[model samples]
Target: MGVRALMNDLTGSKSDKSECWMSLRAPELFRVMEKIDKEYALVRKDAQKYIEKIDFNKRMLEVVLAEATVAYQEVYKAGPLYARIPGGLPLGGPCMMKLPDTVLFFHRMKLRNDTFLRVNVLHNDMVNMVLRAHLSVYGLHLKGAYDHTTTGQVRGTLVHTPTAGELGIFLEDIKYTIEGRYRFMGDRLVIELIVSTLSIRNMALKYPNATDSDPPVRLLKKNMADFRTGLKTDLDKWVQDYFNGYLIVADLQDIPSLWKLREYDQYKTSKLAAFTDLAVARINKRILDIGGDYIRVPKFKIVAAYGLVINIYDGALRGLDTMYRRSVATTVFKRDNLRYVDAIIGFKDLEVSYRYVVNFPPGPLMPPSLTGVLRMSAKDLTAHLSLGLLMDPEVVELDINFINPPGPDDITIEGAANILMSNFKHILRYEIATIMSNSLMYGVGLLRTLPRCEPFVPGMLRNTTKLGKFNKKKTLSTSSKNSDEARSKESNYTRPQRRHGTTVKMMQDIGTK
Candidate 1:
């Protein structure tokens, strides 16, 4: 009677149209349609929120990327590449000879050129004694009066020059050079040097039993080459002994604003959290194979492939000096002072293997990745020309486990519980990848700033201050001025004394008259 009857009167077909109107009025049908409408609206709202969330995450990532780029540039600008080795030979520098016999020399020497290291052997009594004892068979005399010229070169007359045969050996000049790679063995830093070149001159044999059969030029060449080869062998041995059993310490500074990012407004913090979650998820999914060890990121591949192993035991976070005393494990933190975030990390033994490729195949070779070509071998010329490089794929294996801390500045039981609840491994992996990638890039920039060649300067071997002589002269002048003033004052007082004595003499004469 209600809407159904009205629809029937209008259409003039009561049966068909009436049933349609009646179906529309049913409660069950009305409920189903309403439920579908409500669900559709809710889904539409959720879809809009999801799109916005994605856009927000993208913006947050962009900000982090920009900051990382700037930090990288700044690290490079700060000059990390320069070698921190002493610029010149310091006084009392330690030196030791390794080849024929182990002998320690007291005198320090400085590098003059790549092939020349200037040393004062004759003046150093200990060095001279050792050389005379060892080099007597070669007719070389270390005991001789020598003059240090204004140019800092040692010039002297040979003591055995007259006694030696017509073609005697003369030590024309002694120099040294460093010619090996700087590398790491276990936890030690090592470097070796070898006598790659030598300079010698021939002299007439003056002794009675001098052999005339051997040509002077040929004899000199043979003797000098032998001496150099022997010296190089000794030097290699000395370097190994010196650096053996030594530990290298790596000090890394704390990040100042790492934890502050969490204290932002609700919207901003939420966006950052989403971004971090996604980043962690992506890293965990990769499961990269580095050398033999599986790691979360590929950047660590360089360390494994290149024998650069980070020994955590040798490194300490300087800011947490007090924390280390409490517990070695507790030294690593999740957050500190509401401003710093720490990623707990553990390292396994690092393995690096290298192979040089001298020859290339007939067909074209595949291009290498960024981590693959970090170091190129100069020995492979064919590989360089044909395939753009010459080295076997370096195998690096480093096993690492990252542990997440509970909260900001929390290192107690509650924090540990929190870490267990939140997927700690995933969070730690993300944090480590972020920190290490930036560190590696920064290190490369630093290496680029090192000087290509040793700097050559006369007084570089010693701490020769320019103002030393001037300061001495100034002191002498001031002392002389004070003495002159005292002398003038004494002369004036002596004249007055004589005048007073003359008056006394006149008074005595008047009394006698």
Candidate 2:
């Protein structure tokens, strides 16, 4: 044979192996590999008897995603600061960033453009499609089309400037329907949804019975008695259909992040996230030993009488908070070399210089949130108008607060507020991108706008000068002195004001709100 032919023959099948004698594993070893696969087959019932490991299946999880809308709602509270609703927001642009004027203005211009698609865009689309599908399955017809088509999108503000008393009472322009979205990669359904928000308003659609001249939404709201007893049958059936189809369409390997987060939270934050990563890494090393690219992977399936489904829709975007927290911890660890050997283990000996430190709550201090909120429009085309507000919210803040202090892992309201603002960096950047993407969404020309805000400088300086008198005294003490004459600064227009209050830092807002 030629040199090339000889080389091929040498590296070929178990033939001319006089120079090489590689031993093969026995049949028993194959059984072991097969057994290794079987571990993933059985449920973890009676795990303590056979597995003898601390939550063995728990080691199989790495990351989790939560219901973004619900997560957002949990942190949402009425911001007290006077916010300037930019002209663009009222004119169909998304200015969901709710904050005081100075901060709100800056972020509205920033989050105008972004790459991370808002979860709501996916949600609205999904809800529209699935609801239509449900109606089709039920053979229901709409009396009229959405308002955006029949009547132009109301050019004026849908809501008025609300007072402090109207804090919890929002004039809901939309109504009840489970608005959420899910992505299917083959058979897995990676879904995100808001099961419930803390809000208690009925924002569901009312079907119209009148003629075209007076096109009010047709409301098929379930009888309040029926609703209180249980969801109406049609609604319940539709719910099952939506979730079942949502999950079944995706193959078993495409489970979503929202479900994972719920499951993880149920387990009380089991250390599963860490163990699964290490185990998967170990399995990969085994494949590397055999000079193969293929590695052992997870085979968790949601089997039922209908069929066996396995899904693996694992995305970190679902766990925005947990991921952010981890990111922060990682940065700190990397900066500090991740060693605690030399540091004090407890705060027993810790002494503070400040006297009488008091803690306040988190929500009222939060900057407006400006991330993840997408377009919500009541534009129904097929003779069924959207029965709710089509709000394009621009969030300016999300405050993270403690529910209960489990030892020293608690955060103050001020700390949580800072964290929320820090994470909202993406929101700011995306707003700017939105402007660049759409031509009609242009901002005030920089040349013309720059000179306009300059005059407010003198006013900002005056506020600073006034802060000195209030500094050495309590808020009530100074306010009472000028009770009648003083023009109390607007709470919403907190911009250009120096920080005040000693107890302001301790607000711990747990958003069961």
Candidate 3:
């Protein structure tokens, strides 16, 4: 084939341009080839250095990406958390029971907004009249329209303040029936409600005595029936939105670092380490709220459920002493669980302390009075954790049952008081163990917030393999062996002895060369 045809066949190009170029530059091509061949030896000599530099840059890029992946994972997990409210919280605050200010704030906001939605927007009176009209068509007339008085005792400062207290709502003489069920949506619990009974308060409806046979009454019933599904749907949506938007949401980004320190008292030392001059320069900014004063992340968290639920954190468990002190100072636990215990049973001056040191030696299960302190063992903490998955707490009963009824003078009642005090220790131990186990399980999978997968970076896979227990042990052993070998090599060799003048002469000879 001619050169043009041969070139086309080699490159699979369907153009006459290659043939034209070849004809015009054939001589120049030969000269260029010869020059390139002459310079090839020089280029080859520096190629190894360029290759090594490229490899170093590539490894650095991989490391940066891997670290970015880890940061992303941590930030993601810190965002959304699931909490389950436990069943049967005490009617009155008990010793050691505490809530965070932020938690109480959100809860109050939820209740206030919910009240506004039902009372102002929906108008319960109007809803009751509609129910009355619908029921009249069916020949079912009630004695009175539905209504009740709601009284709530909310003991707390304004929502922004850093104080937590109880909110007790009492509904007296309810005239309407609300049938509701709780269900889980993904990891969240939600309530679905239906108002089942017509009101007993609104008694002046115009069609109070209309029968199903009446055309107007039948038509009213039909319209109400058509909208019943839509009404229920809207109520359910509002409930879910309240939970998702306000109730269960929390900012937990500080938790990992807080847990690492194990207690709030270590915040200053940790902050100093984290925000040293060198660290500040590298990060390009100083951190605010280093003392956690203005931080609004609640140490205690709650989520809606059929029963009370809470997300227990490592910081809270470790910082029990702080909580205990605060509770005492504020008298948050001053309210009695059994109001009649003192007046009726003659039990007086009941005092209890919730302060505890975790992982402390197991010396005594209960301490003597005036030294009402108990040391919690680490082994006991872990053992109770195994029982977390097994317990599905539906109803919690808190009863200070007497091991033996207080015998007369048995203060004679001081001995009986000690027995009561000893049982309190048992209850405290059970509670602490449950909280610790739940927190540990949260780290693994009870609330696995992030996916378990290695970052898709070049070096990340190697790092993941190194993170394994066996691989870590192997690396440590190899490093120790290599270090030992290095020490032995140093010991085995000796420097040639030289006279001071000879050493000076050798140094002068080297400098001259």
Candidate 4:
């Protein structure tokens, strides 16, 4: 009948034999066996899921690894999150975390490298002037040219109300617009991307801004609905709804003259940035979630990033059209998959009249004055780099201008290509570890498969390896052509009798001359 009764019956009727073992032991062996089975069941349930899809999408593991690198860059930039040791500016300053002048150490020091160092935050006095000029150009009259401390807007606001139509704010100075190939939608901003703009807009500008609120975006004080709306997914909808505009007048005049501007700077940026980042991230995630092939994915990311930028310029077009042409943010990269992105949050080259001041020490003498603002060729003129490729652990190794710096004499297309190819070969040989693709793409290694091929294996890498996965820049035509030729079993596609500019040619160049 029951298990225990059955056991006793079977034992029989051997109850005396079973009783002797039980008498010797403190714990029953069956009880231990039952506990072990229960433990294993739980472990099996937990482990089965991970093991089943161990090599599937793989993002769960990659996300962890990738995010750490970003976190490290952030921490490393913020301070020596890695290891901070103190020294002066030249000696170890670049490597050191803190400056001689005291302040809470940042998780990362925003080392803004610009085409021109003077315009970056390396000096404070320059940035202030850039802001003041931006204010004057917009006629926000927010701050006076001579006085750096005045945070109030009094110019035309003194004479009249900033009618709802005045909500005009924009960036006209950024590179994509400045280079003059971009367009502006009359009702709302829509940045048209261009090829030349990839490195400038997507690399330089975005990285500086991305490093957690340094210049602290100053979009507003009280409400951030504007920033949110500006960041909405459907740019077309905003165009339809806000065909008429709204001018946001900060009651800056409400504050006293003695009050400082920096008091509000950090807070103001915090509010606006939260709105922008949330909206951008939301839109990007949605676009990626509805995925297509690799080709379609990057376009969605670029489109989302550009939408924010174009809207900023379009919003401020009311006044910006004066000193600046309507601004635009362009997507670049000959290949669709490789373009750069950043919330073209705004693009006006900021130009300001500035005086650097340092506070003097108190005693027999006070700490002398030191102050300045970031100066640029223009106000709000910035290039931002935000894109999916950036998230890949593959390090970026090229910049547009550097690859082909302008010569005193103009260089032809062929010459430029030669320069680029040389640099590319050099970088490939050394700088790159992961030449990127949709997944964790890597280079060919020296190994091959077992004969049975239970799972296909890697073949050996030659001393001069040519086999590798395509990068974002590689084209479908190139790949298809290669595949077609491979099907034909063609091995002599590349002839090496003599050449002038190829990698093999380079050896020839070096050998002859």
Scored against the true structure, residue 326 in model 2 reaches a CA lDDT of 18
lDDT for residue 420 in candidate 2, whole number 0-100: 49
Encode model 1's per-residue lDDT on 443-496: one tens digit a residue: 211111111111112221122232233223223223332332343343232111
Expressed as tens digits, the lDDT of each residue in 61-118 for candidate 3 is 2332233244534534554211221223211111111122221111111111112111
Error of 4 at 373 (Å): 47
User: Which window of ten consecutive residues has the lowest lDDT sum in model 2?
Assistant: 381-390
lDDT of 4 by residue, 48-95 (tens): 343234431122222322323455445435542111211111110001
lDDT of 1: 0.21
Off by more than 4 A, model 2: 1-176, 195-408, 412-513
The lDDT leader among the candidates is 3
lDDT score of residue 306 within candidate 2: 22
Q: Rate the local accuracy (lDDT) of all candidates.
A: 0.21, 0.20, 0.22, 0.20
TM-score of each: 0.16, 0.16, 0.16, 0.16
Q: Could you list the CA RMSD of all candidates, in the order they appear?
A: 39.8, 29.3, 35.2, 31.7
How would you encode candidate 2's per-residue C-alpha lDDT over 1-513 as one tens digit per residue?
A: 587774443243433121111111112222332343244223222222232233211211101112222332232342111111112111111211121111111111111111111112112222111211111111111111111101113221111111111011111322223432333333343332222111123422222343446533322222111111111222323333434443554233322343432332323122322322222232222222222221111111111122212121110001010111110000000111111000001111111010111122236653442222211111110010000100111001111111110111111122233344343233223321221111011100111111111211121121343323322221223443222122122112112221111011111010000
Superposition error at 271 for model 3 (Å):
51
